[model samples]
Target: MFDTLIDQFWSLTLSGIALGFIYVLVSLGYTMVYGVLRMINFANSEIFMFGTFATIIISRDFLGNVDGSKTLPLPKLLLTISLCLIGSMIVSGLVAVFVELVAYRRLRARGTNKLATLISAIGISIVLSEFMRMITHSRPTLNPRILEKKSLFEIAGANFRIDTVLTIVFAAVLFFVLDRFVKFSRLGRAIRAVSMNEDASKLMGIDLNRVISATFLIGGMMSGAAAFFYTLTYENTKFNVGFTLGLAAFTAAVIGGIGNIRGAFFGGLSLGLVEVYASAVLGTQWKSVTVFVILVLVLVVKPSGIFGEAVQQTRA
Candidate 1:
């Protein structure tokens, strides 16, 4: 019975864990930015899409070509990864910042209803995605690094690879560092205070603009890293790549409770695992449906999210 249970359950659980890591990395941005702004930047997804493509370009330049790309020296690989990560982070963050400056900042000053902001965000999202689609022609581009990594092990009878391990370990480290940054650091304190009461925090001499920008930067950086990890995993990308992934990560943000950092982490990880399991049980075709179902169920029970601020408290 135990052996049978292992055969039946371990596969989904392990795979879920791996997928969950990716989700967390992606979702962290949404959670962080939302915590401060209380505004959803729909274009955030496009920023992520940009990061993935940037990494692909960098990888191509570093390697010779796609199929026949030369492997970088280990030092170069490290440099490539670091430089690409930083470059993508800065690019995505700047885009996020620009969106705020152009689209949402003035409206926020006027105390616009979140609905208007959401619509504007969606508009920006569409424009950015369409522009990208036009630029890249909606074609899928390959990144062999993610797919080409050799499988490294069969842990507990489950196949695991270097990519899988790296994804998980990197995500864990990022989350830990972010948790510390948010909880123990001065910037984190400022961010939390603003989230609790933006105007009141301002009276306390907090620069709302700076705090908000910082939030975008952190989120953008996280999204950038996610771009790399995601590219590494799937090995190919295309225009609008960020849409579905962004929605899924946002769903994780919701399921875990928006404005709750830990909630995003748990929500993302949970969603990833659920997707993995769904692929095994219901077939991959129905997996997206399965995700929406989970979202609906979570909303019905815990509208505020698992670790999110209680609705009553936030309203008060």
Candidate 2:
């Protein structure tokens, strides 16, 4: 195991970074919602699950690439991917907003117990997952090969695939844009304000509903993007796929600091690196166990995570 890991260290590192970015994207949704509402949106995983289906639907139905047997010209391929991205993002965003309205809004307005809200979110997650399970007949759905995945480059005996490189770069760009938006835009300010103090923001005439809705929307879109990359990397998805990935993303958010955006980003990459290395060195079956162990250690040592503060207390 040590020899194998040493031989594949660079390759594993690159793979881990790519996977980490996906976690980062998904964790952003959780962190953002927590930032504002101080509640974990368990249903956000279902939001991601929906985005995967949307990507499959667009690829299999609209693009007419069912089994990925057909190869497209570069232009058409780009168009197809763009359409899939847009469709996934839009559908996920809508589902997120709907979840907020149906599962959270009324309960929040009524000033119900936080446990009730969390339970409602979990119920929504179950419903959405089961609904998709029935639709897909509880089978794994394969994603069409939108891009011809080939090795683009190599460094230190490690070859990088085009899809992996693109996924990492694209996710990085999205993160940068999101960071800037959260820091500078008007709506971003509203979100930060609400996260800091919902009552105070409301008193200052900020539309809490609108800001909250937008926060969910943005987070959903990020998850959707992550979903697209996930399918792109893994080439398939299952109805319950969100369960594992969501757990990982939530762990990432917690490790980074639940309510901090930058913390989520760093936490995700850190977890990703740890998981891949552990998988290579220990075994594939030990991956989940290793992640949880790290989680427990982190909590025991520093419950506030790497950021040491929530989003409200930090600029993130």
Candidate 3:
């Protein structure tokens, strides 16, 4: 096991980082919603699921890449990629807002218990997943290979693929932009104000509902972006694809501190690296096991996560 890990260290590391970026993107949604509403948006996974399909739809139906055989010209490929990203983000963001309205707003207005809201979220998740399963007839679907995977260079024995590099760079830039948005923007200030003290924010004339909805929108967009990246790397998706990845992202959020953005990033990267290394050493079968073990340990030994504290108590 050790020998296997040692021999493929750089390869495993690069792969881990790329995969970890996906987790980071998805986990941001969880953390942001938790920061504002103090509720777990279980349906968020489905938001990501929707984004994946949106990518497929935009690429195949609209962009005329119905089959994977088309080799796009450089300019056309760039346009298609941009449009796909935009479509996925818009669709996922809207879907997220719709979920908030259908599953959460009424309950929140009525001041329902947290458990009820949680149950509602889970129900919505199931409904969305089943809806997609029906739409796809429970079959796996493929995304058009718009961007071919080619190794750009090698570091040590590891080859750097285009998709992998793009994923890392894009994730990093998006995270930085989001972090800045949350810390500095007016809407961001409103979000932070509400998270820290809802009553106080309301007194300050901050529209709680708008801020909450905006939070969902931003998170959903991030997940949508993650979906784009996922399809780019894997070139395939399924109705149930989000289930496992969602759980992993949720775990990442928890490990990094549930409401902390930076924490989510750190937790995701760490989990990805650990999972890859563990898989190489112990075998692929142990990947999920390794992740869960880390999750359990984190819960038991440091429930507040590596960063500690919720968004209400921490810096935005």
Candidate 4:
């Protein structure tokens, strides 16, 4: 197993990079919410799941059938994908905002216990998942392949697919844009200020509710993008699909240091690489087990995570 893995190392590495890009996008939702509210929005998985559905609906309704056999022209493919991306992002963002309003806003307004907020998030998560299941009649829906995978290039005898290359490049560009926005934009400063000290930010005249809503919106948009890419790769969607992916993404966020934006990205990439290498060495069944084991070890060694400062400091 070890020798075989070594022989196909580059192939596994590239595959891991592509998977890591998705994880990073989803993990951002987890990290961003934690950064602002000091709590996990468990419903975020559902947010991602909804984006997948949104893509399907928008494609079938507006763009017509996406035939996998015949390659779409470049302009048409780009336009179709752009529409899917917009539809998913908007739907997910709106859903996230709704979750905050319905499940979290009242609790926060009343200054309820953190446990209450956590429980509420979990409840919302369940509701959203079941709602989606009911809407799809518990059936697995297939994504229309908008971009057919063709060999983009070869690296170390591995033929990289065009879709894989595009996914990675698009994710990298978005990450850079988001990083810059968070670091330099006016609203970004407000978000940071609120994250660091809510009371201080409020004293400085920042509207807490507005900043929190914007955080959720941004996070949801990222998850929506992940959904589109994931469907593009896997070409399928199921009700429970978000659970495992969400768990992995949450683990990535924790491993990178929950609440740290850059840490989420770093941790996601690291986790992806680790999972792929481990699967190659141990076997496919052990992939998830290896990821959790690494998470435990990382937590044991550094509970605050790779980029996590003092965990206590992040809490309100």
Tell me how candidate 3 scores on lDDT: 0.90
Clashing pairs in 2: none
The residue pairs in collision within model 1 are 16-273, 64-70, 143-235, 146-232
Can you rank all candidates by lDDT, best first? 3, 2, 4, 1
12-36 per-residue lDDT for model 1 (tens digits): 6766788788778778888777888
Error of 4 at 308 (Å): 1.9
For each predicted model, how many residue pairs clash, with residues at least 3 apart or on different chains? 4, 0, 0, 0
Model 3, C-alpha of 138: deviation from truth (Å): 0.6
**Model 2 — which ten-residue stretch has the worst lDDT?**
307-316
Q: lDDT of model 4 at residue 1?
A: 58
Determine which window of 10 residues in candidate 3 has minimal summed lDDT: 307-316
Q: lDDT for every model? A: 0.78, 0.89, 0.90, 0.87
Tens digit per residue, CA lDDT, model 3, 1-316: 4998988899999999999999999999899999889888899999999999999989988888866676778998889888988899899999999999999999999999999999999999999999999989999998878887879999998899998998999999999999999888999888888888899899999988899999999999999999999988898999999988898898899899988889999989988888888888889977777878888999999988988664434433
Off by over 4 Å in 3: 309-316
Q: Is candidate 1 or candidate 3 better by TM-score?
A: 3
Q: Is candidate 3 or 4 superior in TM-score?
A: 3
In model 3, pairs of residues that clash are none
Better of 3 and 4 by lDDT: 3
